[model samples]
Every structure is written in structure tokens, then in C-alpha cells.
Target: MAQKLKKNTAIALGNFLSQFKAEGNTKNPDVLNNNLFYDDFTDLIALSQSHNGWFTPEQVYFAIRSWAEALTEANLNEWLSRYDFSNVQPKTVGLILAGNIPLVGFHDFLSVLISGHKVMVKLSSNDQKLLPFLAKYMISVQPELEESITFVEGKLENFDAVIATGSNNTARYFEYYFKDKPSIIRKNRNSVAVLDGNETKEDLIDLGEDIFRYFGLGCRNVSKLFVPKGYDFKLFFEAIYQYGDIIQYEKYANNYDYNKAVFLMSLFPLLDNEFLTLKEDTSYASPISSVFYEFYDDLENVKERLKNDEEMIQCVVSNNLIENSIPFGQTQQPKLWDYADNVDTLTFLNKI
Candidate 1:
């Protein structure tokens, strides 16, 4: 398929995606093939939570909206312009996707197809529906692309290269299994926020979005905090109190009750406000409904610590305290260029 056709098809898919929102599904008659896909996609959004209890309509809508925003013509052109697709040799690329978040592995799917490669995907059982449905829509837009995409039910084979995402244990297996192939193997990583005493109440409130979105299941969710010594929690708690309604969700409430009980039984001191818990710990990965925090006496030391621990960290949200730190509440909203684990997916695709 021509590169222009692929890009145009993605833009049309984006238009198709834009109609399904948390507020309601709007069928735009102008969008291509909407008559065929619009109702089905809307029903999928409504039924997603049944497949995975965490896949609520609101969370699924947010993921779809993010993709719709990313697949615009300008964004696609700017992202693709940096690479030379000329003289590209088409190869089959295998993908083993992760299912922690809604559409978590779509970027890899998009990367393989956009880079002029055939993709044989082994979908995570937890996220089996959304991407394959989108793939069908893409094929509808450009029939030529139907041959370039395949969803495998069992083990993947006949691939020149592979990309896989999983937990740390699964990553070990992936590394051993695909060691000979040119690959990008992503393991566990967690995002953290660095805090100073001077941040406004609004800033802390916005940080709530970073913590609670997707029920804190995604690698990009802020799971830890680096706070200055002697900082008070009163203001921070008050700022984030607006998001306490999240605890009302059945799954989140169950997690909150269970995790809080476990922590209490373990005799770990925690600061709680009914919905979320804050514990002082050194670990970056936190349990659902909880956030681990560490105190630092100096800013310079925090920068050194983050730099040395960059591999275990996905994103560092800060108020410009560190160089290249992401702004507040933007960890989940990664730009096309903001590749996962700081490894450029396009660069990997362009080479393989």
C-alpha cells in the first residue's frame, strides 16, 4: 500500500473514532463507512466493561479520544516527516501486546503498518477486542491494507522482527524467546511526580488526573511521588479531594478497601482520605488506590536519583525542577513522538 493511502486511512479512522465519546456517541454522517461501523463501535464501547471490569466506558472513551487526536493529518505528517520511508523493504513484524490499559498497544500496531510492514499481532487476551475492531475499520478504508494486517490466535511465526510489552517476568521470557530477532522488549516501568512546597493548589489538583486515570493501571500513571522534606499533606489532600468520587466505582472501591486493610494489617503508616492512600516508600510501582512517596532534602540529589533510575521510570512529572521533565497531568497524554520507555518506536520500525 502507498504511504499516502495509509496516512489517509488513519485520518479517516480517526474521524470514525471521534464519534464515540463518554458523554454520548455521535454518528457523523460525513465520516467514511460510518453507516457500517458507527453502531458496532458504539456498542463495543458500552460493552467493554463486561470483557474487563476495568474497561469502563469512560476510560475506553478517553483512550479512543486520545487516538482520534493523534491521528490527525498534521500530527501524522509531522511524525512521519522525520524519517525517510524511501527504499523501505517491507517485512513482517510480530507484536505481543500488553492489556493493562485500553488500547495500550495501538501505537505499536500503528507503527508497524505506517512503516510499510506486515504486522502479525498476538493480542493480549485482556485487550482482544478494541484493536482488532479498529483494524477491520482500517481495512474497510483501504482494502489494500487487509493483507498487511493479521491477528494470530496462537504463537507468532515467520517474522523478521518483533515488539513485545509485558510485566518484568514476561519480559524475561520474551527476551529469551526472541533474543535472536531484532526486537524492542519493554518491561515494567512506573511514572512519578516530583513536588516542591511552592506548587499552587491547582497544580496539585491537576495531579489527581495523573494518578486516578485508568484506575492507575497503566505504566504512564503516576505511581510514586518525590516530595521535599518538611512538606505538608494538608494542602495536597485538599486539592485532590475533588477526585474522591473515583472511590465510588465498584472495582476501585474494592481495591481501596482491600489495599487499605492490607496496609493497616502490615502496620505500615499511611495517610488516608477514604479514597486514596499515601505511603512513604522507596518503590516506584504502587498498588492500585495507593501512591508511594519518598522525601528528598535537596533538588540536586533528586535529579541524580532520577537520572540513575531512569530505566525503572516511565515519566517524571515536575514543575521544571529537572531537565526535560513532563508537565503536570500530561503523563497519560503522550505525543506521537513521546515514545514508550524513551525508545523511539518509529526509529525501531524504520530500521527493522
Candidate 2:
């Protein structure tokens, strides 16, 4: 089974990579307008957008390859070594995926697959095509996985365990519906940045990726920032505005215009642009909200506030402040070693 999974993953990854040069080169303007998985051209655009700017076809090809490499048996074995799954066997696991970002629920899917369990995946309508396409490729490589994988469009029942991701509102529904089952029902989480006022313009530009990637739709996108008192907003805005082309999305432009108006009406100060909005706020979560910045007079005092809101926070983006934080641009591109909410995913799978 391990060998089959490895071979299949490799073949599927190769198939995806081959499509890039062939389908990605067609220059149809209409094809550039839709979301990923609707078509090959749109999928290319989505990949480029998620990367914070334009990505070369080769770069997109390599990124998909990297994801497949992580699914190999050797990699899976190394990841699972930290957890004791010897006696744990789950018959069925239900997965409710969030489609806010591309392939955001993939890790959970991989966890269920490599842990020797059957998966009943309920994909988000927004991202219905990619998972199934990838699954079909996998099955093409290793036909045995066909029996273990099932894609459903409606409610799932009789699963031994569940792993669901959604907004804070949907969490209540998940809690009530899956209360009797062993589950991990995730709520909303926002990432933040702590700037020490010593950062270079280059650092701020990279930090922009954490802020504006996918037009700030992903949970990993940094919505709020903590800067030293008297930090200059001018330099920050200048650095991030290089990726102004993202505003070309009509939906994103409408969001920016709407949010800008709301802030102005409320007498809130703002930094305007075709793509992003910068404002001042205390909260970390931004929903079509601008790149809000808050000044911290004392670093320790800010740390105390962050500790209080850890549940609402995902990761802290900084240079080298502490153990839990990552580098500025590394927010959207999470390493396999970085587990969600610091939960031991393999252990969670084993317990089921």
C-alpha cells in the first residue's frame, strides 16, 4: 500500500506539472478571470494570485510537485514517527473542508489517508473540483485507493470521528451535529505581525505577501499588525503597493471600495489603494477590513494581550521574537513541521 501510494502520488504530480506548459501558455483573457479548478487557465491564475503576485509556469509546476513530495511514504513515515498510532484504527473519518484558501484542508485529508483510514470528504462548493481531480489522478496511479475514498455532496453520518473547519458561527453547528462523535471542530483564527521598528524596506515588502496574498482571504493572511510607537505608515504602504495588480479582480476591487467607504464614514483614518486598505484597529480579524496597524508602546504589554487572544490567533509573524512565530513571508507557505493550532494531527488521527 505504501509503495502504491508513493508511485501514484508521483504520477499524479507529474500529470499536474505536464499540464502547466501545455494549458498555461494559451493567452485567452476570459480564461484569466475565474477561480481555480473551473478550468486550466483559471487554475493557473489562482495559483499565481495565491503566491502574492505573478508566478512563472515553472514555479507553479514545482509548487505542486513539492506538495506531492510531502505525501510520499518516507515523508509520511517521518511525520508519523512523533505519534504512537500502533493500536489506533479508525473505521471512518468525516472531513468538512474550508475553501477560503486553495487546498487548505489537504493536510487533514493526507492525515486520514496515510493513517490507514477511510475518508468521507465533504468539499466546499467554492473548491469542489481540485480535490476530486487530484483524487482521480491518485486512483489512476493506485486503483486500490478507490475503495477507501468517497466524495459526498451532502450530510455524512456514522463516522467514527470528524475533523471540521469553518468560521466561528459554523463551529456551533459542527459542535451540535458532531458532539457525540470524537472530533476537532475548528473556529476562526487570524495571523498577526509584530514589528520592532528595525525592519528594512525589503522586509516590509516580503511582509506584504503575508498581508495581501489571495487578497487576504486565507486564514494565514496577517490582518492586523503591531508596530513600535511612532512607526511610519508611509514606508509600510509604499513597500506593499508593488503588487497593485491584484486589485484587477472586480470582486476584490468592490470589497476595497466598500471597506474604504465604511472606514471614512466612521471617521476612521485609512491608506487607500486599488488593492489594499490600511487602517488603525485593535482587533486581529479583518473581513474586507484594511491592513490595520496598531502601535505598541511596550512590547511586553502587547505580548500579554496576545497571550489572552491566543485562541483567536493562528501564527505570529516576526523576525526572531519567539518559538511560536515564523518569518514574515512564511505565513501562507507553512512548513509540514508546523501543525495547525499546535495540535498533534497524527495523534488526533490515532486516537480516533
Candidate 3:
């Protein structure tokens, strides 16, 4: 079964890499175009807008490819060689995918398959398209894997282990139902950036991707910024203004306008562009508030405070001031080695 899984992984990697060449023929000029699941990508911009916010289809395609390549035979074999999965059964794992962002559940899906476990995935209604499409393509590439993957529309029971992702509110329900089972239940988490006064204009512009990508919906998206007391917000705002075209979406524009009006009614101060709203807040989960940044006087003091607020912070974006942090734009592009919640996912699955 391990050898078979390795063959399936290799085939899946080949199918995914083929997409890079296919992208040229699938171009559209409209930014607000829709990218349906089964069809070739059209209206790249619109397809991106349909997700959470506006990101180019090229960006989304490359991101997916990056993830797929990480699951290749070479990498998987190296990881498995170091870990013992001899006692792990091949048909006892169930994965409940999160639909908050495009292909958000791919990592969990890949983890289960490469670790010698059958995955019964419950697709999020909001994102029912992409994963199944990829699954179909994968099965085509390696017909033997057809028996290992199943996409179910209803509840699953008697699984030896489960990995579920949900809001902090739904996390309680997951805990109650899967308590006796070996599980990885993920609650809410948000990403943040730590900015010092020394950041270049280019750095701030790149930082914009962390905040505005997918309209700040993904867990990796930066919903808040921690800036030094004397830091200038204008420079930061100007740097990201190139993405102003995202407001062309009537829905996104409506959100920006509505949030701006609410702030005005409440006499709250803010900075605005055609597509995004910026405010001063400590919260990392912003509903309609596109970009919320807060000022801090000291970096050391803020780091200490963050330790107490770890649940709210996922990745910290910084250039030089914060040690052991990712760069301004690298938050969404996690390496294969970086596990969610710092958990050893393969080991956890092996134990189950």
C-alpha cells in the first residue's frame, strides 16, 4: 500500500505541474471573471474576486502548483523514511475540509494520502469545486488511488481519527463529537505583521499582499498590523494602492463603502482607497474592514503581549526587526515543513 501510495503521489505531482504550461491559453482580461471548478480558467480576475477578494488567477495557479510539488515522491519518501508508519492502518482517517479560502484543505488531504491513510473528505459547500476536480484528475493519473479517496456529502462515522477545521464557535461542536477519537481540531487563527519605521516602500507594498489577498479571508491573510508608535500609515497605504482595482467588484466596493460609512457615523478615523479600508484595531479577524493596523511603541513589549494572544496570531510578517518571522509577503506561502499549530501531523496520523 505504501508503494502504491508513492506511485499515486508521483502521478498527482505530474498532473499538477502540467497546469503551468496550460495557463497561457486560458487568459481573460476582465479582473472580476469567474473561475469555475471544472472549466478551464476564464476571466482570471473575476474568478479570483469570487473567492474572498481579488488575486490574479496566475497567482492562485502558481500557489496550487507550489503545494502540489511539495507532495512529490522524493519529499514524501524522505519524510516517511524518518517516521515509522508500519502500524498505521490505511483506511481509518477522515478529513473535514475548510472552505474559507480556495484549496485551503489541500494540505490535510495530501497529509492523509502520503501517510498511508484512506481519506473520507467532507467538502465545504462553499468550496465544493476545486478539490473534487483535482481528485478526479489525480485518479485519472493513477487509477489505483481511486479506492483510497472518497468525497462524501454527508456525515461520516466510526473513523479512527479525524482532522476538522472550523470557526472558534464550531470548534466546540467538533470537540464534543470527536472527543474520544484521535483528532486535530483547528479553531480560528489570524495572521499579523510587525512593522518598524525602517520598512522600505517596496516592503510595505509587498506587505499589502498579506492583508488584501483573498480580501483578507484566508487564515494566512494579515488582518491587522503592529506598527511602531512613530510609524507612518500614509506610506504603507500608498504602497498597496496598486491593488485599488479590486474595488471594481460591486460586492467588494459595497463592503468598503459600507464599512467606511459606519466608521464615519461612529466618528472613527480611517484611511480609504477605491477598494480597501484601513483602521486602527487590535483584532485580527476583520469582517468588512479590509486592512486594520495598530500602532505600538515598543517591539519587545508587543512580542510579550503576543505570547498571551497566540490563539489570535498565526504567522508574524516582518523584515529585520522580528527574528524568526517570515517576510512581509511570504505568510500565505508556507513551506511543507511548517505544520499547522506546530503539530506533527504525520506522527499524529500514525498513532491513530
Candidate 4:
């Protein structure tokens, strides 16, 4: 397979994805095969939440828009340019995808093919529809892609390598099973934000988006906060109040009520803003509708701790407080080059 063909196909796929946005779906007259695929995609967006309660049209649109923004010709070229794909001997890469958020496995699927390999994908039950649809659309753009993509319903076999993502427990199983093959087994990781009491209300509001987008389902969502020792809750609560309507959603309301009850039952003191709860906890992972927080006395200590616990973190949000940290509200809008878990997927695929 010529890598350029795959890259151009990806750029075309990006254009197709770009049509569906949070504002609304607007068919691009220039895109290929709108007659066949556009209406079906819109229907999928409208009904996604019925199949999976968390997949509200807004969230699905957000996921599609993220990929749309990412697969531009310029962005794809920059991300793929660092590696040499000239002599890549194609291999079949088996993928065990996770469904935590919409199209969570797309990067892996894209990596396998764009690096001159075939992919056999096993879709997560929660997210089975979106990727396959796009795969078909891409194949429509270029007939050659039909031979390179496969979706498996049974045990994954006939592949030289595998990539799997799941909880820590599943990671163990993936390790033991794929031990014979060169593989990348990903486990759970969460994002966190560090606050220095100087962040403006605008910054905190954007941080609210980082926290509430996707109902806090994505690994990129900020689930914990590191705040200065004397930080006040007044501004933080006020800034995030825009998302208060999130409690109106039944699923999120249930989580808010349940998690709050559990915290109260455990006698843990919490700072509540009615819709969201803030608990003083050291752990990085926080339940839905609740964000765990730790008070820090020194910025350097927080930095050192994050360095030591790097494996457990996916993204760190700070306004230049931490080196290499992502800016507030932009976690969900990661660039094409931003590899998940900081594992360079493209490089790994090239080597295999």
C-alpha cells in the first residue's frame, strides 16, 4: 500500500467528519457520497443516546468534530512526517477497542492502516456503530481501502500484533494472551487539573468544560483538582455553575445523587454546589459528577508527585503551572499528534 493513498483517504475522511458539528449537521456539497451516507450519519447522531444513554447528540457531535479538526492534510502530514514508511512491510494488526467515549479506538484503527498495515478491529459494545460507518465512507472515497479493514465478532486471530485497552484487570489478561506477540496493552488513566488560586473566572469556566464534557466519561476529562492550600471555593463554584443544568439529565442526576449519598454515608466532608460535588481526596480518579481535590502547599511537590505518578495520568491541565501541561478547556480537543497515554502509536506501528 502506498502510504500517500492512505493519508489522502484520511484527509478525505476528515472532510466528511467535518460536516457534522455541534452547531448542526451541514452537508458539504464538495464531499463524496453524500447521497448514500449523509442522512444515515445524521440519524445516528440523533439516536445515539437512545442506544447508549451517555451518547447525547452534542457529545457525539463533539467527538466527530474533534476528529474532523484533526485529520486535515497539513496536520496529518506533520504527524506522519517524523517517521519513514518507505519500506514498511504490511502486517495485520488486531485491535481490541474500548468504548468509554465515542470513537475512542479510532486513533488506533487509523494508526494501523496509515502506517501501511491492515487492521482487524473488535469493537466495544458501547461504541459499535460510528467507526464502521466511517470505514465504509472512507472506502467509498477510495475503493482500495475495502481490502484493508476488518471487523471481528469472535476471538481475534490471524494477526501479527495486537493493541488492547481496558481496565487494569483486562490489561493483565491482554498481557498474558498477547505476550507472544509484540503489543501495546493500555490500562486506565485519568486527567487532572492543578490550580494556583490565580486562575481567572474565564479559565475556571473553560475548566468546567474540561470536567463536564462527555459527562466526565473520557480519560481526557479532568477528574481531580490540585488547589493551593488556602484556595476558596467561591469563584470555582461560580465559574462552573454554567453546567448546572447537567443535573437535569437523568443519568448524571442519578450519579450525582448516588455518589453524593455514598460520600455522605462515608462521613466524608464535601463542598457541594448542588449539581457537582468536590471532595478532598488524594486519589486521581473521581466518580461521575464528583471531582476529587487535594490541597497543595508547594507547587514543586505537586510537580514531583505528578512526575512520579506519570503512568496514572493522561493529561495535566494548568495555566503554565506544570511543564508540558495542556491548557484549560482544551483537553478534549487534542491535536492529531497528541498520542494517548503519551505512547507514540505511529512509531510503534511503524516498527511492527
Per-model tally of clashing residue pairs: 0, 0, 7, 0
Give candidate 1 regions above 4 Å deviation: none
Candidate that beats the other on TM-score, 2 or 4, i.e. the better one: 4
Candidate 3 Cα outliers beyond 4 Å, as residue runs: 3-11, 21-62, 68-82
Q: Model 2: what TM-score? A: 0.84
Question: Which candidate model has the greater lDDT, 1 or 2?
Answer: 1
Tell me each candidate's TM-score: 0.99, 0.84, 0.86, 0.99
lDDT of 4 by residue, 232-295 (tens): 9899999999999999889999999999999999999999998999999999899999999999
lDDT of 3 at 9: 52
Query: Candidate 1: what lDDT?
Result: 0.93
CA-only RMSD, every prediction:
0.8, 5.9, 5.1, 0.8
lDDT of residue 196 for candidate 3: 81
